[model samples]
Target: MIAIIDYDAGNLTSVERAVRFLGEDCAVTRDLDLISKAERVIFPGVGAAGSAMESLKKYGLDKALHEAMKAGKPILGICLGTQIITSFSEENQGTPCLGLVKGEVLCFPDDMKSPEGEKLKVPHMGWNNVTVLKDHPVLADLRPEHQFYFVHSYYPMAKEAGNVLAETAYGLTFSSVMGRDNLIATQFHPEKSGKPGLALLKNFIAWKP
Candidate 1:
């Protein structure tokens, strides 16, 4: 069974519903034992980074999650869930994260000054298009320019370009999906992205560690 981690963050049910729609077994629990035993673990969140990190620590979930990942199980993180996998985040007073991936979570630059100098809206809400950048199992059947639901102001800047599997253009292009070993994360809400999203979830479920 797949495990949808429960940590009082919003959108957990939405994720669970999507999993059930795919006709798969998923358990939503905070129990570390269940998480460790699951074939694939999903960490979904939509909240303040500092608060989330505190909750994770309070529940001793940080260690549990790390143990699961270390055991070479496939893990997927969404939204703030994705951010926590990174080394640290500048959001919510700069909280230290899971350190599973070598990167930092940051907000859109106030000056809007990249080499490209692109200007777009903040939060990057609603449906946005993501272009495939690298090949990965999570994106097995997904095509370039697939539309996915997104709702966030902060984005991930991967330290290594090779870690980026998909890019999406907002004020400027940013990492939409990142993959490293058994770890996979997406800034976009695949659970709400319709058929393409469901396909990706199915692929994740069938992914081999």
Candidate 2:
């Protein structure tokens, strides 16, 4: 079974629906054994990093996630879910995170502006094209610049450039996908991203790395 980590801080129904649509089994749970034993794990999060981390710790899911990494199980994190996988986040006033990936989650600069000199918006809502940087199994057969749904003010700056699988531009370029070993995460929400997104989800389910 594929387990979706339920730390009580994510919008998980959409992910569940998408996985089921692919004709696979998935479960939402905070149980450590379930997460550790699953064929794959989805660690999705929304809301503030501080609160989300709180819940993860409360249920010992943080430790369980570490265990998943050590075992080399395939795991995917979505959006804020993506952020907490990193070392730290500027959100919730400097929250320390999972550190699974060598990166920091950062808010878009308040003074960030487009090259054309227009002020860029925070929370980069709506559809944006992801430029696949390195070939990743999750993006193996995807077309270039396929659009994905994104809704966040923060994005990760991966310390290890090799882990960056794709990028997207807001006021400037930012990492959209990061993958290393059995771990992968997306800053965009595949559940709501339509065709390309569903294709991504399907690819993820089939990915063995």
Candidate 3:
């Protein structure tokens, strides 16, 4: 069973729906015991960084998440969920993150321009093609130019370049997929994405490490 952590973060329903579509037993809960016992835990969010952190702390989910990671259980974070895994975020400017991964979320500079002379837009909404930078089980059967849905302004900057598994161009190439050990995260919204996105989820469900 996969446990979807519920702490008032947005998009829980979509994630749960996808998990069901994958024919997997998934439960959405705030109970730590359920989360700890689940085969995998997915953290999905579509909101501000600081508020999400507060919600996690309020329900003691943060500690549960840390413990799960320590146990080497698979944990996947999406979008804002991915941001919180970093050390800190410039999203709310003073917000601290889960620090599970060494990185920071930063907004694109207004003057940032792509190689094609297009000014990178904020809240990078729409379908963007992701270029897989490295091979991993999460991206096992995924094609190189897999299109995923995205809607966010901040992107993660890892301290070590190898942490980045995929890169998407938005004015400049940013970390689209990050992986380490039993953890995986994506800045894109797989639930919002179509077939390819669903495939990625299925891959994650079947992933060993």
Candidate 4:
């Protein structure tokens, strides 16, 4: 069974529904034992870094995540989950994060603008395409034309370039997909995205790494 981690960060049900639609057994839970035993774990969230960390600590899911990573479990992170897995976040007056991946989350500059010189908004919402930087099984089926849903003000910057899997441009290009070993993460929401998104999730479900 796949464990969809629950720490009160919104967007849990959508992920659960998507997983079920793919005919996979999954549960949104805070049970440490259940998380540890699950074949794979989906750490998905949509919220502020500060409050999310507080909830993670409150439910001890933070430590559980570290344990799962150390055991080489296939773990997937989305949106807020992707942010907190980094070392720190510029959000909430500089919040410390899981440090699972060597990187920092940074907010987009206020004066950010598109290449065409058009002003781009913060919290880059709606559909955007990602440029795959490195190949991985979870992203094998994704084509250049495939776009994913995004809604975030901050984006991850990995310390090691090798850790970057894909990048997307709003005002500027930023790391959109990152992974190492058994862990993979996406800045976009595959659950909310259409066929391409579902394809990514399906690839993840069968991904051995």
Cα lDDT tens digits for candidate 1, 1-209 = 99998877889999999999989999988998888788889999998889889889988889988998889989999988998889989988789998888898888866564357656567778998888888787798887657899998899878888888888877767888987888899998989999999999999988996
Off by over 4 Å in 4: none
- Stronger candidate by lDDT (1 vs 2): 2
lDDT of 3 at 185: 96
**Model 1 TM-score (2 dp):** 0.93
Model 4 lDDT, full chain set? 0.95
Using TM-score, give the best candidate's number: 4
Per-candidate clash tally: 0, 0, 0, 0
Candidate lDDT values, in order: 0.86, 0.89, 0.89, 0.95
* lDDT of candidate 3 over 126-171, digit per residue (tens): 9999888788988876786668999998888776788898888888
* Candidate achieving higher TM-score, 3 or 4: 4
RMSD of each: 2.2, 1.1, 1.1, 0.6
Which residues of candidate 2, in runs, are more than 4 Å off?
A: none
Q: Candidate 4 on 1-209: residue-level lDDT in tens?
A: 99999999999999999999999999999999999999999999999999999999999999999999999999999999999999999999999999999999999998998888988898799999999989899999889989899999999988899999999989888889988999999999999999999999999999997
